[model samples]
Target: MKPKLLTLSLVSAITPITLLAEDVTTLPTITVEGERLPEPGISREKPEDMVGTPADAGDFLRDIPGVSGTRMGGHGIDPIIRGQSQTQLNILLDGAYVHGGCPNRMDPPTAYSPVETYDSVTVIKGSQTVIYGGGGSGGTVLFERKTPRLTEDKFIRGQVGGGYTTNSGTKELFGDVTAGSTQGFARGIIEYRDADNYEDGSGNETRSAHTSQTGNLILGYTPNDKTRLELGLEANRTEDVLYSGAGMDSPQADNDTIRLKYENQWGTKADVYYSDVEHVMDNYSLRSLTAPMKMRVPSKSKTQGGRISHNLLMDNEMEWTMGFDYQHNNRDANRFAGPPNMPTPTMLQSIMWPDVDLTQIGMFGEMQMPVRDIHILKMGLRYDRVTSEANRAGQAAMGGVTPNRLYQQYYGKNADVVDENNIGGFI
Candidate 1:
């Protein structure tokens, strides 16, 4: 009886093995189900297909509903979403911040971004979440890059393309390359565009000649299949950006960015980034300095921020996500002046930006639960603390009155700083 029991146990174990070994056509099937978030008023675009459109960043927004742009020339058009533009709308490049340099809105944040280099552009209308930085009253545009998984086989991938437009003699050249093994990967991208002035329908030449170039490099490491760490560097330059409707042309605009990110299958993610932008726009560089209203304004902006977020899965039926984010920005400006009557130029150096500083900190959380087979419940809450201040109280040399005096006359005294606390939620 003992021998028979041992034989029966061995046969049972070996029977399944023999069945699996003989199986050649039968295999297990896998089905994956997905659900969309309940958030509304969100729009997304894939910019790679937009290469056929104009080379400017504003060109991509033309197809999106409820979005428009202010055309100053043939290039560097500022985007307006639902009648909101400039600082009113938050523009982020890979979760980083950059400020425009032109006071007349000549060089918007979009101008600094290379549309071809990004994979996704997400637009959220109105105040949505505090996971990102604050002051997104009008909306938010997030430019994102997705990293590909490393394969077991070592290989390289790349794309090269170019295009030309006859209307303005515009030319664009772009290339993307990636090389990797199962453990690590590296990628690089470059996009360059140059265009001459384009003629209106009436055959009149417009002041829109421009040249721009951007480069980005990323290095990533994967210790396991479920975790990834990455570092990214980017540099962008735009030269000869002409604005016909505005008073000055941007001779040189330079931007630098650095980013670090980490993610794991445990639903934890983090990002740290910094960006710096310097802009030099003068009438003399692109137009005549001897003109009656010759002016030059050079400005620099520095921004740094970071965010850490986690996803908590509860009982396989619900998900909760919470995060904290903070951002700081500093801006300084100095203006140079000259005219046909003056032999020497005088600088209104201290007054352009007045050394502005903006700081914001926020905490946010969201929860999603499956109420039934076909229904879901979603809720979110966020709180933000924002502060804005200016160091200089005086006005430019060209102005007859000071900014502090004007503010005091209108609002009252001791209005030098603004502090605000906001709490928002949705269900």
Candidate 2:
């Protein structure tokens, strides 16, 4: 009986194996195609598609490879890329340059950039081209807006979004709308953000509270399928910005920008822009006074720039571009002192930035040729004439010493006027 039971068990197992071997299936072959790789040392992103909500351009940049930021407070992060920062990195907003008003860099250029409004952000990690501007040894950042396309069926489009962060009590609201026909279009964008002091893992609160608002409008006219003209106006205001790493808090930081652009299918492009900034910082506005006298600093900066370029495509598939650009930046800052309980500062303590001006005019040419299916040969040349001046360098300060005299005493060089000629290229 035991031998018969064993034989039956073995037959059952063998029967199941035979049935499985007889049953067979086939699957169709599949092929997947991924996106093409981007050019070397260049990265681009769409703000709306980013993983998380970023407070500003600097905050968004920190998420990129080889990029980091200096956190001052709840907002206004200063971006650092590959161990270089500040003037080494050139930042452009819709092809316009916006210089910050804070001398200590509490409000770097990225601070004025509202991430939600821009369509695209491009980062060039190294000196790869000579078209944007000069002295970008570290890299260049471009925040750009694309032309809105509308048809007879879809003449209007818009989007709105809001978010909240529980840990930091941060609230954000942003929206944009576009209305157009086949001939013209008008677009508007608005954003608001508010944040309170945040706590760390230990539940200790940090000094980082701020409020910001931004608005922008763009009008575009498409004369034909190949030509377009656009005008843009933008404003940004921030208040009661607290900083833990600094001695003062920014009570007001405002920016206004205007730009006009022209483009055609012939690869011709031209743009002119102007940006103005006003920043005010005080020791008593958002925090308790630590010194005997209250201190405040008010600063202003203005930047005007323009560029024109034309691209030529050869029969051999090579592209050549030639352009000229000019920029002028002016800045002034003053410090004031008063009693701790004073409602407003009264005494002029010092002339921190005494009407400084920097101007640059440059001409550049570049050519790109395909070296095969996978490689490209690129080269460029640029020349710039820069002029710098301290208009009020002889003005008296708190200690009755002139800024020019201090410069002479410290560096043994005159600070009144300086000029430089720079020539650069890349391969």
Candidate 3:
């Protein structure tokens, strides 16, 4: 079954009625207007052109139509597009995927993406294409950086800036630099942000504070004008993040990513990436020790993916794109509890994520043809194979109870490996 959403708003206007000696002759007609209809297809915009400074990709996406976000804390705002969120939406960072380590979604994909570091952000609403992957029923968001072109006249380019928000005492500093000749170029970026708890308009304080730092480097080799190869490395670290909406505060959340990409003038492209994330959250580290016992959870996630595609143009002005993509994700998390004021907790409270692994492989083909004057037709077909397994489902945890046993007790189902094959198409 598909999910649905409904929203309603009410507005009231009070106007004084004036009494006059003469009788009323005519009354003016009133018309009410609603929001404009969303436009179809893709929307791309330069990050520098965006109004105001955005803390992360989620803040940047709020400017786009049909996009909204849920604020978790001072940082990490989860984005929702066209009422679709989480796994239903495909979020990509320079053709790579980064999964958050927090099981409660304190750190979504967008949380790691620094808006100013990228050249452009693209949003494709709805199921517009199949080349990006499968199950993006809601939409897709791509944060992309462009390759730098250097010449003898202008061999260096970059930007450095900083901003501050008074209400929250939020401070940010960022820098981007690139240098090289026509054959190759090297780029580097660094960003740092620190924020304190903020107060609402009514002067109520919210427990939202965080500190984050990010570093990225890219080396591009352009042997010829038609061919380009690039390697990218990135790291993000967040510490002492406090959240008002969640039970625990994050002490450390870190991410590391590496990617390689190749493209040619012939419309051939290839990309491969690997990402790792580590997250730690505890109730005592950043907040008062109100509970009788100290609780903490540490989780880790890893993702590896690649894609290869080619575009072809026919004599009839029709375009065809075909591609294959594969992705594998692994996650493990554990919760621990001990007496209050205990620095290190050894007791195993629960197996939050019992070493789960998910893999998906997909192949897709799409065609766009010009039918006649002012008319066009597009179609696409995709097939995907998915496999999932919990390697430690039977491992004992918390009173010698296994995850599989808990699953059986709660849902009355066996925790066994599963596989699925899916086919999707659009016209």
Candidate 4:
């Protein structure tokens, strides 16, 4: 076995790729009469590409069958892949979980990370392979960050663009730069966007217009021909919107992440890898709601994890990949339930430690065999030990006689026990 180790998100064993325009859908070049327009507006000057992130990622998924999304406010609608959301499916950032903010179908996972960060996004429509890890009963979406490789020129290049809508008449921008030599290189990207309240197709104004900002950076180094090392950072934030039910609208947001990854190959035939990621999300109260509703709901979360894997080439037409991965997700959120018109200007506070921790340890292996030059077979299997827990933080009643706080909320009154379990299955 030559050293050729590999890595990926515990949920989406991602490999390097060149994002090609090949899918299950295709039309004959000859056509019915002559070589003409290919399916309407798709021009040869501009190759067809998938659209992900910014909520409109589903447009890229059109090649897949039975997928749709309900209109939220702006950006695009949330992805509705074969009638499933969140739990039924698994969403990965650079291949890991970014866990969304809304539960009622607003703010999809792809919205957490920008699309330009990855070379490609792998969408598995079903329980495909345990080697990619489990939990994707509905399916899995891997928003990947490409493996780093510096060019010989040692130069930096980037691009920026923006667009507007008929209703909200929005403004947005995107740009990134990459530069390095054969030894090491680094890249970074930034995004800024905003929109005013938009009217429905019928001219009815919807208060859902909002604003968002995001930034990303990546660093890579190569010591030899077989192994490599890389690091990354990303930050995102969003303001308020009228719709998208999550009890309270966002006034301020702080979402930042950091990642460190290392890859080492023994020879051309063997490999080793180590990668870790940390993510954070925070929400602040809004002024409009505080004055009238006297309501406040703030929450924060942090998730960090690491993984390692090895690869083996059995022969020219057969290959095997094996590895183990571990991850943990935790959060602290505040929920408010108060007032029946008025309690004589009284104040009450209920706080629950909505914090939860999930950890998974697993070993997986994959085998691929080529039955023919054009036909091949692929399979993978794994076993995982996963556990989850939730503990009550506390609760208290506070008042200033005249009610300094119009209204306040708390969390975990249910004495929520940690939902812990061990699980394993196909990818």
Candidate 4: tens digits of C-alpha lDDT, residues 38-119: 4221111110154322433544444455455565555435665567755677766764556554333345555555554455
Against the unseen true structure, what C-alpha lDDT does each candidate score? Answer: 0.80, 0.92, 0.90, 0.55
- Please give, for residues 171-276, the per-residue lDDT of candidate 2 as tens digits: 9999999998989999999999999998999999988989999999999998677788999999999999999989999999999999999999999999999999
Question: How well does candidate 1 match the true structure in TM-score terms?
Answer: 0.84
Q: How many residue pairs clash in all the candidates, one count each?
A: 0, 0, 0, 21
Better of 3 and 4 by lDDT: 3
* Candidate number achieving the greatest lDDT relative to the actual structure: 2
Between candidates 1 and 3, name the one with more favorable lDDT.
3
Q: Per-prediction TM-score, please?
A: 0.84, 0.92, 0.89, 0.71
Where model 2 places Cα greater than 4 Å from the true spot, the runs are: 1-32
Error of 1 at 257 (Å): 0.7
Superposed Cα deviation of residue 393, candidate 4 (Å): 6.8
Report lDDT (Cα) of residue 404, candidate 1.
69
| Sort by lDDT, top down from the best | 2, 3, 1, 4
How much lDDT does candidate 2 score?
0.92
Index of the highest-TM-score prediction: 2
Error of 2 at 148 (Å): 2.5
Encode model 3's per-residue lDDT on 230-348: one tens digit a residue.
Answer: 99999999999999998999999999999999999999999999999999999998999888989999999999999999999999999999999999999999999999867977799
